[model samples]
Target chain A: MSDHKFTRRIFLSGAVVTVTALSLTGCTEPKTQLVKIEQAGAFFNPDDLTLLNDIAEIMIPRTGTPGAADAQVAAVIDAMMMTWANGATRDLFSNTLQKIELMAETLKGKPYSSLTLKQRQSLISEIDVRAFSDEVPDYAEGYKRLKDLIFRVFYSSEAANADYVPIPGQYRGNLTLDEYESLTEAYSYGG
Target chain B: MADEFDVIVVGSGVTGGWAAKEFCEKGFKTLVLERGRHLDHPDPEYTDMLAPWEAENAGLMPESFEDAGRYSMLRKKGRLYKSQWARFFVDDKEYPYSFPKDRPFMWTRGYQLGGRSITWGRQSYRWSAKDFEANAKDGNGVPWPIGYDDLAPWYDYVEAFAGISGAKDDVETLPNGDFLKPWEMSCAEQFVSDNLKKNRPDRPMVIGRCANLSEVRPIHTELGRGPCQARNMCKQGCSFGAYFCSLSSTLPAAERTGNLTIVTDAIVTSVLYDDKKGRATGVSVVDRKTKCLRKYKAKVVFLCASALGSVQVMLNSRSDARPKGIANSSGLLGCYIMDHFGGAGATGVVPGFEDRYSFGRRPTGIYMPSFRHEKADDVDFVRGYGYQGGGSTRPRTSHTGKKVGIGAAVKEHVGKALPWRMRLIMYGEMLPYIDNRASLHPVKTDDWGMPLLHIDAYGRDNEKKMLVQAAKDAEDILIAGGCINVKSSHVNPENHIELGSRTHEMGGACMGSDPKNSVLNKWCQAHDVPNLFVTDGASMSSCSTQNPSLTYMALTARATDHAAKLLKEGVL
Candidate 1:
């Protein structure tokens, strides 16, 4: 009240006119949730979200660039395991996606999204080149945790927001990478 | 008009924005206060224009939700948890404090309105007469009655209005200012600064002086601020006020000297001390959104509230003529509590620049300064250790658990730049421990019931043998500079040491000629309340190794110009 000039639209219109002028003077207190609902809770299972969105579209399929299922990265890994996985990282990412559907029904049979995209990219390159930390195995740590959570949601989407330069309007710092790609514009090489 | 008048300034930060811009440009009538909430500088709660794939937890923040698990202790601090600079830091569960679980300090706070000078690490440097003659030449606790030619003209008047950016190089252990044009360094930091100066010619390096404008003057384009477009996105605040914060340079020059005011959720919580006008006759605050209590008055108060938050407002200011708090009649207000022993160092890989890269994002790094200082103590430690870090022709965070590889060649190898690599880190100099103190928690109390402080502080045994000889002398200067697969930090003796992970906190009301062992004197005033001053990082008499907010803005502009020339000689 001592004029700090903030804005979340003047704080939800001054908290909805102070809770509608304290409920039109019927004054009942205990109200406060000033907005923050978002909880629907699901963290996979519609057949492990259709085998983790068909193994995140064969590790980012669409080629002319926009991959990881064109960036809907399994709905940001189901909203980061329903608001950021906690219970021991949602039980170690649900026992590594149920050991990648029991290692695709004991080595490529019925489910890991019913194989064949060249045998699911050669069993995701042999369960992602094995040995993925915390001492491996859980279908080699769920193909290295769903391939590092679909490369951290396709390197932060909007189809990897054209490798930022943010407010990099200018700042030379001694060029020459062909004078920094002929002065500016040429960075997007990934991540 | 604001209950307080000729000078109040409890803590808007960076020593209450240089004592409310030198007490409102010498005409006084200032106020300031701010225990969080107002944040204006490019404020839309600045996420330095987001884009690192704008949020949905991209810039980081997923330690399992609930507002990022209420900032899991600032996600163990490193680069202050960046999911949009963790919503401008501070909130140890509604500002609680306490310490000592086998010595674990981590008291990092940020509390808005430019506090924590909007998440610091603006690394400024300067402090030199061998860091004010190393605490009276290593007896080690109280000395600094002002040195480096009494702060080289207040660090050339706050680096000519806070611009800095480096490359001066006079370097007698970092002492050169009024800079501006610098930020270059990365042909793999000029080949590890010419192979660590052909092997340690007293450890040279340079570059990172910082604060950032990299050329701006016209008094910073008449103070609207610009330059620093390096866009390393300064903990998401700078919006081209290109660095030097406290709402981009001294509370907008004390809001263009119309004799400042500020307030914002107030909260000072102590310093009134009247007892027959012995002096400090103001401040009691509270509101932080209606926890109520008020007070104000003033003739001069200051206490830039940090470094154990102005000794937790002079230990919750109880009275009875200094009952262990207020001017603290040298019960040395909260003993000596300090900070900077930093998480040690290392990292490697610098082979060849691969055709010289790095064109911008140079938000600084490449300092080195300490070189085991104090006329080369040569170990058994007393004070030294600098080496900040640099060289990254790329490959640092390919994000989450070192991503192996997948899709379009891992999105063109995580937007490229993985060849050179470097790092350094170190920090050191912690000494000050009179049982590394900071008191208060007689029983905890917080969320505005106040009293939680308690912090104990640690890092002794001369800061664990200077963080294991500054991490094996930063892996022997990254394998003597051509760096290979180096690596360091993991210094043991059974590890531990997380105390305030380098938020660079400082002493607890220190300064002393001898107000019976100190609680502000060598002009940080209040030998026992003469108008009660306290230039922040609370009067730091010792914790030296540079970067202590450019000596708390040259000791709050040389103690608010000696309390505005003793308030025009009426003697404060």
Candidate 2:
């Protein structure tokens, strides 16, 4: 598949696709939908999809709510990389994933896909901490971009967030936190 | 033989809709011509109901499409081009206008049946008395033929029909209209407004008066219009008919009268004037798709094709009787170009609103009315500006702020909302300058063989100075109102501001008391051609900081009333 331009049909349901096999021990069952990863498109291979799926789950692991993987964040990112993102954004996303693989090899002496669940969690946690610190690393900015996209897509999805109301009938300017939280669904506006 | 009607309204926008409605209701056969393709009410193209994830690329256009030169003007504004609503804007490559290489003017346009009203920022306000008298007092332009009093009842007339929602705030400069119940401000906004009232009472921040229906009335519901759902996605076109647009409100009302006829893809090239009768005979039109030339005869014509659009038509209508253009007796048909200049603002975090959140989107925010009614030592400009912005609770996620947290902790953090961040963007009045003008390009022509409009206008020293003061004042006001990390942004040092970027282009065919200096008189009737009227933004004497569409509607209502009366009396 080319890095740019995937007709909606080819991107959504066509091409060699697989549901991410989250077989890691102690991993929670994906309560929402499974992420459909294409074989290759905009800098992702089959192995890279596995690594990304694991990373997304570790970042927003299911508790009482659905996690990033559950929300099909990886699938959305793949589509965005091909269609929505520019060359710069695609490059950053690719570079960030490559850096994660290099770090796994450097620290754990193995590929990120081959690492144990505990090892993957510890390494990603360390990277996340270092990404936001004062002494910025080379991988910091790119990693943040990837992480931001994951969180953005996950939160915006109906699978992850139940508060996405399409048409809010009224506007109340100062609803108290207690009153807001008591509602089944929350209200929001603007980007 | 040409298609005959009592009235021909060119451009089915805000003003055109009002013009058609009034004339049709008054028992006149009105024909409305639109240059763009027809779009029905509750247009299927509206993406308002789509959720973020459901929308294409999550409400983002492809980077390649956005980078195209056609949307370069849209990129400067930064909101429309990147969003799903980008389709509403014209592709500049297809319908082009030019300006000086050094002086760029962003003429943001939406040329469908509803025109730019589909994508208009619906903050409607009536221009104050101070606004009318400022031009004459400051000697920037000619005196306004009509004042606030002349347009007051007309404002009431339009507001009652349009269903404006606003507070009757006692700010004389920003007059209150006959309104529906007002939208409320957020906790942080109220806190800042209350603080400002204590500190600077003269500059009290009040709820923005807007066209969104807070409560649907009989007048609105009679035409299938409903109350605003507060989606805040009005630019995508409201299927609810909640917020006002020509397709939703006025055109439907006009259609109900059975005296209205609409023809889309009919581009009016020029007004056809009769030398012997000394009046406009009809209009020359070209089919947008087929390039088929045609004529339409009418007893009267109202040019509501925006400021630049109407002026371009008049400037192209050259003849032996009036070679300067149709209503060129004043020789000011395409002069005195103006738009509200705004590239200044302040934004900061409101410290104590974390415990409060708003439900749904209010279509508009609070406005700080212009305080500089007259000259002062502190004020460096002849006219003033207003702020149209509000506070919103910032979204919290794993990557918010300095930290990009991981694991279950990140999800919990994302669940809670962050403190409110308030933004205040200032839009200042642009003084009418005869030097800042638009004319037909001698060499260039569009596919339809109409001359491309050549605009030569930019923000001046006065506008730049106003922005500087506006930024400083915004920072000061926010800091005094307990906002943290206040930062101000102003115009670029090299290029002060983009004139037409705000989409408030006004004063190309200005109204004035003296027939020698203006194209249109008080009734928006052309001085040379009594049967022709230019009632859109082109007829504006001055560009006020307040949104101009409301005034355009009021003027159209008022002008058509006069035209229908004259027609009845056999004055033509």
Candidate 3:
């Protein structure tokens, strides 16, 4: 089994340590670190990063192959939010996190952080079905969007395939219908 | 003192990059001017590594940016911020143009050193001999000043460096290029191509000739680029110079020569003409960063600033000798704008073949070369259209709105994902009509104060007719290949080019044999100004259905060599 732990500490130590430190320091020290802050604005917070990982794990939890969380989709999401997303999007992300937390409190009578893995998994499954069926009207759309983002990030990510998905080596231009069908199916299912 | 060079190539785009490389290689001091900010090649910015989910709006275009209307054209085309890599490509405040109420011109573009070449669909195909002679043979637009023979060698040269990966299709309508090893087709695509070839022999489908290097040749390896690792993340800009964009290929070569000097954030306002010498002496520019005016002199000038952009510059270059414009002696400087009519084709699903899978993401599709104006045996339209499309298995999105969360249901759904056979798209050719021209608007200017191009181009009757027929043909072929749920979509005949959809926008300052009918002479040199050349798509007399960058590169190389020889022999 692959270690799918995507802790904030690990992320901070890896690609974004300097950016994270600069941003945190900038908030404390005002005038001198303005430029650094402006540049560091293109970095995500540790909590949001962890939330992204949790969301990916919830969306595409590991089965036979490596799942979204294992790919460090949270880190990928964090990088994208900082660099590409605009203001309203950041607000939406915050709202989504808040909503997820609220849902956990309502369902399990505890914060998502305090829930065990099994409890967390149960809550995620319940929320997903409710969102899919349009039973939870308030959080449905946001949850769906979040689910799609997680899947898209994972499916298109390098970590989604691992050894499970069959990546075609050479193109063969004269295959039978059956041969083509099998190949396309493997591609869709991530092998 | 104002910096003087042997040549000043405006716009480091497809043609400009080629001109810079050729001139620099020829040992001429060349300065490439770009209005956008300078972006270094290879690892210019690290944003390319980002994934779509990482995006704030989940790769959606920001409402604020859309409201500003700066990238209205780009946004309309569905190219949203999947990553930070695409953010720098558009400025949401400046660069505005308006189309007529009913006519929506999606002028999708990027203005970095490499221009839109970074985001371009690198589908490279050589124009057939028939395409070169079409204008004259059919009495459409002006006849091409030069033909396939003139461009053949340059095509070979550019192909060698660009590293096009494709199979040699001996179809006369779509000539084969000097190619590297072709990328493998998806199994579905292979089935379709074989079936289409057998069932419809007239339409021969082959792998799309693209600039993505499947195998790194010595020339490409020298440029610090490696072979494509089959990562389909091309539109975001390849970090590996595995593809041929100006940033990846030509501009880098020019940089190595040391004679190349690139001045970004400087927009060329107008070409300064010397009436006595009958040539362009220099160019006046507006610094985009500071709004300051600057002038740069050169012995020769190459207007490689895209199709409409070059035409705008030429039309703005008015002198006392020619009050209309510098190269408007023929009154055809800013006329006959043409873009290939895209988005007409059929898509369907193929059943079975659930076991065999493939590896690596192929960035391109199978190409069905044009069969329409081959022998001219009872063809309705004068010109022809070609097919560029591919196959893919239906992804999880196909089950969108059908399934719910990430559980057993999702797993079962993913396991049983349907095999979507292929989608065939026919990019039809639009003939050049005299009325479909671009000119200066009465009262509008870009950020640099140059008059905006009032483009009034649209596909004519013949083009519309061709698209309709091509759509029908696409449907028939898909149906014959055992594709289910085959459906055809007709391209909107009006504004089908979508202003800048193809980005192969051609013909404003067109090339022709007669100076009375065309702006540029046979060598792509301006008829009025011998030293000034427009070697971009503006030099194209007619629009062929194929992607135009390869042709533009070939023309630029030929023109560059011609200009160098002329300069060396004191012809200039």
* Cα lDDT computed for each candidate against the true fold: 0.72, 0.83, 0.73
The prediction achieving the highest lDDT against the true structure is 2
Query: Which pairs in model 1 have colliding backbones?
Result: A60-A68, A189-B415, A190-B414, A190-B415, A191-B414, A191-B415, B106-B500
* Best candidate, DockQ: 2
Cα lDDT tens digits for candidate 1, B426-541: 77778777667888888868767878888887776777878877888889887887789888884673566766777887888888788888788877887878888888886787
lDDT of 3 by residue, A96-156 (tens): 7778888889989987766766677788888778877736667776667666766766765
Worst 10 residues of 1 chain B by lDDT: B392-401
Error (Å) of candidate 1 at residue B310 is: 7.3
lDDT of 3 by residue, B173-275 (tens): 7777779987777667767777877887777778788988888889999999888756566776777887888998999999999899999998998998887
Best by TM-score: 2
Could you tell which candidate, 1 or 2, scores higher by DockQ? 2
In the range B338-402, model 2's lDDT, one tens digit per residue, is: 99878899998888866777777789988888877687898767888888888744455334424
Model 1: per-residue Cα lDDT at residue B487: 85
- Give the higher-TM-score candidate: 2 or 3: 2
What global local distance difference test value does model 1 have? 0.72
Off by over 4 Å in 3: A1-147, A150-191, B46-63, B79-81, B374-380, B392-406, B415-417, B491-497
Worst 10 residues of 1 chain A by lDDT: A16-25
For model 1, residues A23-99, the per-residue Cα lDDT tens digits are: 00011112321111122224654455445655665666667666655565655565566444567766776677677
Instruction: Tell me the TM-score for chain B of model 2.
Output: 0.96
